[model samples]
Target: MVVTVGLARLCRSVGRTASSLSVPHQAAAAGLPARTRFISTTPASNLQFKLDERTAHSSLDLFKKNTGIIYRMLGLDPSHVQNNPERFRDWAVVLGDERISGGRHYWEVTVKKSQEFRLGVADAQMSRHDCVGTCNTSWVFGYAQRKWFAMTNNKMVPVTLVGRPERVGLLLDYDAGLLSLVDIEKRQIAHAVKAQFKAPLCPAFGLWDGELLTHSGLEEPEGLK
Candidate 1:
């Protein structure tokens, strides 16, 4: 079931900006404000790309390994956004650093639906929590028998494979700037870290061994194994 609600009530400013790529003017007219504009991460940053030579018989051969997705932002196209309902800027998905994917989707989404999308697993469970999307902060949402959460602000948000643990969640105490790894069975913080972002940053995580891995810092890998 698709629950269609009007755009959010919280409003911000819409700065004069333009998308790098040329999209039709009315593609995305967000109702968000300019000042509220935030990009989770810049796509230009040097993220690791593992190319394996093993697939080929020659060592010179390389293949893409690590499955890390990057998020970023840019201005909007006048024509594409001309018919937009939003008075502010809406988030656009830019993949390969140059091409515009048009919209967002999660990894957990059907393989067909998320094939070229730039979004991550949905935090639908987090809708119940109260969050002020301004300052960079992270929030936790319960998933499965364990608890999982996503930390996001206005900018780009990126999620990666975290651990092999059957149950896991990414959670944070925004006010405290405290990020935690929760053990649902024990109901405690298995691991934790302090955020060091002057501006808002969005960070999502996945399971590894039984450990929590994030941009904040890495804990020893000892997952639910």
Candidate 2:
């Protein structure tokens, strides 16, 4: 299912303060590459996949590390304000607003700060079978299908594919990192946009004043800053 809100809206929905946004946290992986984060009620990591059987990518294993997963932010609707530090990542902050050319809504979310945090799926045992994801709380944009899919980080994960809400496209999603198109009828993915840059801290994408605004999260226009 398509998220009710866009990625921008997703960010703003998690209301954040300037302080929270500016927290100094290292984004380094210490030699391990980030798997994938499925934006949902909970996040899941696909570290369970195996090129071979001896080792695996277990979503539960990542959460077990505790160093990467924060359990306090589960199942909370963003936009709820809290007078606490723990709520920083749990809430969605409004970022910008505009009556764009084709958007259904004029609001956007400014994620206060996200430092590669991960959330585990409900039943961690089954979900980490593939080398796909571990964080069930993060959002995903399928490059090949031009659509978005929502999945919580659990062994028996909850995934919503736009147009085809019932089918579980787990194997297909494993390769969704650069996805751009979603084939609902076939329950699969297709097409991909080529890119050359590492992801920015925050990347801006939307329609504004009849122009499609696209830029890095740090490069948000002066007005947004």
lDDT of 2 by residue, 101-175 (tens): 110111112111222221111111111212112222222222112223332221111223334222212111212
Model 2 whole-model lDDT (C-alpha atoms): 0.20
lDDT leader: 1
* lDDT score for residue 197 of model 2: 21
Which ten-residue region of model 1 has the weakest summed lDDT?
Answer: 20-29
Candidate 1 at 73: error in angstroms?
25
TM-score of 1: 0.24
Rate residue 115 of model 2 by lDDT.
24
Q: Roughly what TM-score does model 2 have, to 2 decimal places?
A: 0.22
- lDDT: worst 10-residue window of model 2: 19-28
For all candidates, the clash counts are 47, 58
Model-by-model lDDT, in order? 0.24, 0.20
